[model samples]
Target: MKLWGGRFLSKESKLMEDFNSSLSFDKKLYYEDIIGSIAHVKMLAKCNILTNEESKTIVNGLNSIMSDIKEGKLKIEGDYEDIHSFMEINLIKTVGEVGKKLHTARSRNDQVAVDMRLYSKYKALDVIDNLDIILGTIKILGNENAVIMPGYTHMQRAQVVTFKQHIMAYYSMLSRDKKRLTSAIEIMDENPLGCCALAGTTYDTDREFTTKELEFKKPVDNFMDGVSDRDYLLELLSAFSIIMMHFSRLSEELILWSTKEFNFIEISDEFSTGSSIMPQKRNPDAAELIRGKTGRVYGDLMSLLTTMKGIPLAYNKDMQEDKEPFFDAVDTVLKCIKIMNEMLGTLKIKKDNMHNAVKRGFLNATEAADYLVNKGMAFRDAHSVIGNIVITCEKKNKAIEELNLDELKSFSDLFEEDVYEFIDYENTISRGIKKEM
Candidate 1:
């Protein structure tokens, strides 16, 4: 029988089972679920809600179940309504009548709330650690590639920038994401377990003891508000969604960089795949997947935002819909963090092609203009003179430096022999590249 079946008269349809069964996805929170229950039982004994012997029986049975689960000896019974039901049902089976008293002061309403908060707390920290690994790899690459390449704008060489500068830009964004996760965790640190079924319970429960036992920072002030607040989960997914967007942009560049047209970087073969039809193709499969998965994480945030918009006060069954999105988002971001770190660690950058690109795009023309200005010409006149020089050089089918001083002098009397020295592509690039370091 289901845990709530004692009050119901008939079995739920198979359609209902398939629609409402969270056992499949939520089973992943088994560890967090058990931990919360153990804390709850301890609080029950401390508050005199359970006799000392009863508490001992319940706690011992839970400990055994935890061990069995760790050893993979216990099957997660699927017929129960959820993880709470499954644990309670298992507790009764293990320790007999006294095991049923484990749920004395709390309802599943508060139980699930605490479970989600605990799970999110643990999951968020795991993501933060992985983020540190990703940032470390980027820092290493940034330092190594500091003098390797210059920056670009509008797909044209605008200025020289080290590859290190580009990597550090991403590092700054990830630092912001880490700060966001830290803030969200602090907001969710309160315990909601003693809230029971929305209103404060009448039992002589010790909210302080449960909060301390669960490692929560404090008890929530309002019972109804505590069970209904999903803001913490929303904040976490929002932060994750933003990070996914950053990864997507990075993935797009990685895709372009690996192509024959760019030939700027070569992703490791292990993280890539060969095209079935093209014998010569080794595609960036993992980067492309990170780009593709961005939509799913974004959808998770949007789904929850819409769900919370129309809800009334206190808890509702609609809150059950919250888990799938939050769980999917956490899993998606965690995997991306791992794959991105590994890919960046092994990826190879081609310094030669990056440098070659600098020479083709008239990247140093602005330096030519500035050279005229430094020679006592007004910047407006210098700008016009540079335009004419470019047109003259283009007509002769030559680079800017290929023009003779007499030809340059025709555009402006200020053209001097020393102006040639300031006009090299490397000079312009060096000035532009200095900002990144």
Candidate 2:
């Protein structure tokens, strides 16, 4: 029977059952759903709504069900409609009629509210730990490569830098994402259990009792807002979207670095794939997937925002749409982070290739101009002199440092013999490497 079948005269159609059922995805929250029930039963016992013996029976039944679930013995059934109903019906089967008494002072509205909050809380913690692993891997890679690389702007070499510095930039982005997850978790910590239906229940229930039992920071103050608010889900989606953007950017860099034209890095065999048709191909598939998943996380955020915008307040059925997107965003980000951390940990960096790229891009010209300006030449004149020198080098197809002193002097009298010292590839790399820090 449906949980609310007493009020409805007719059976729901198959189409309606298919549309209303959330058991497939929500079954993942089974542990949390049972935990919420245990907390609720204790509160009922305290309020005289359920006897102490009944509360003991419900808690024991919930614990046994949890054990069965962990052992893979419990199957979530479609006939139960949703996770809440499925767990409740199974509890009754295990603990007899007393299981029905567990819902004495509550409604499904608050039940789902608490379940989602608990699930989100733990998922955010998992994501934060995953980010920590990625961050630690990046820090190690950055420290190891801090002495070799050429940084670029507008897809052209702008300066010389260390691979470590490049990796640290992504580390900083991940750190900010961790902070966003932390803040979102803080906002989800409030308890929504006492707000039965859309108003405070008349059962003289001790909300504080359930709050303590569930380890919630405190009871939600407004009854209607408790069950109705999905701001926590929105906050989480927004955080996940930003994290996805970070992953996209990091993956984009990894993709570019892995290309032969750049050859700044290489993916390990375990992290890359060999083409079926090309024996020579080693593709950065993990990086590509991270880039692709960004679109999915973005879609989840936008879709949920749309679902929320047109709805009236105080708990509408439309709010049922919130869980799928929030769940999807969480799952997507977790997968991206997991793969990214592994890819980062195993990737092989080509410091020699990075050094070689500096040669092709004439990365030392700006540092040469800075050398002239520091030697008391006016900044504009120094720039003009360097600009002409670059043009001369381009025409002659030589690097700035390769030009004979006389050939450079032909462009500007500012070109002294010692100016070659400033235009050395190592000096350019020093500037690039320092800029990252």
Candidate 3:
């Protein structure tokens, strides 16, 4: 039986039941729903809204259902409106009349709100758990690999930076993502259990008591907004999209690096795939899939944004649209983090290829120009001198290191043997804050 519909004479149509049903997806919230109910039941008995005997019976019943579900003795199947109905019906079966008392001071509106928040809380931490793994793996990669590579802008070699400097850029990004995920939990930690039907109940419900029982930081001050708003889910979806974007960027670089033309890194055989016919095709399919799935997570955020836009306040069925997208984003982002961590773990950095590329790209031309400025050349003149040397080198198909000291002096009288030391890629990369490396 549904938790409501005492006045309606007509039964819900079969097709309508199918359309309105959320048991397919919201069944995932069963654990959260039951946990929320247990807290609510304890508060009801304390307030005398439910007798002590009634509350004890209901709590025992709810725990039994939770235990059965956990041990696979119960299946959450059958036609049910949502997890709340699935819970109430089975609850009534387990505890008889006392189970019916479980809904006394609460409505499914607050019931569902608390369920979503509780689920989001734990699931967000699960995302963080995977992020910690990725961060640790990235730290190990940066420390273990001590190769210098070309840093780029507009896909052209711009300056000299180390492999550590490059990968740790993502370390910085994911650290911020971890912080964002953590903060989103705090913003969502207010308890919504007492906000019955939006306006709240006339019953002397102790919201604060339930708040403490549920381990929420505080009770939501406005019952209407408590049941109405879904800003927490949107914030997490936004954060998840940003995280996918970061991984996609790194995936793009890795895919390029694995190519024969770039030849800068080798993806492990485990993370790569071969073509159907061609024997020589070890495609970077794992990274490509990660890159491609980024759009899927982006779509999850956008779908919820659209669903929530123009939605009326005080809870609408449109709010049901939040769960699938939220569920999808958490799953996608966690999987992406796992796959990306593994992909990065198995990569082989081609030190020779990176160092050779760094040599030819005039990546150290800034140091070349800086050497002139140290020798008292005007800053603009120093920049101009380096630009001329690059063009001359390009025309001759020769690296700056290939130029004799006299040829370099032709550009600037400041040119000396020591200029070579300044332009060396190793020295160029040492524009360092020591502890970070």
Best by lDDT: 3
- Could you list the CA RMSD of all candidates, in the order they appear? 2.3, 2.0, 1.3
How do these models rank on TM-score, best leading?
Answer: 3, 2, 1
In model 1, where do residues sit more than 4 Å from their true spots? 148-150, 369-384, 397-407, 414-437
Query: What TM-score does candidate 1 get on C-alpha atoms?
Result: 0.92
- The candidate 1 region of ten consecutive residues with least summed lDDT is 428-437
What lDDT does model 2 reach? Answer: 0.85
**lDDT accuracy of residue 154 in candidate 1:** 78
Candidate 3, 171-237: lDDT as tens digits: 9999999999999998889998889988989998898898888889999989999998999999999
Ordering by lDDT: 3, 1, 2
Off by over 4 Å in 3: 433-437
Residue pairs of candidate 3 with colliding backbone atoms: none
Q: What TM-score number comes out for model 3?
A: 0.98
lDDT of 1 at 431: 69
Model 2 worst lDDT run, 10 consecutive residues: 428-437
Best by TM-score: 3
lDDT of model 1, residue 11:
84
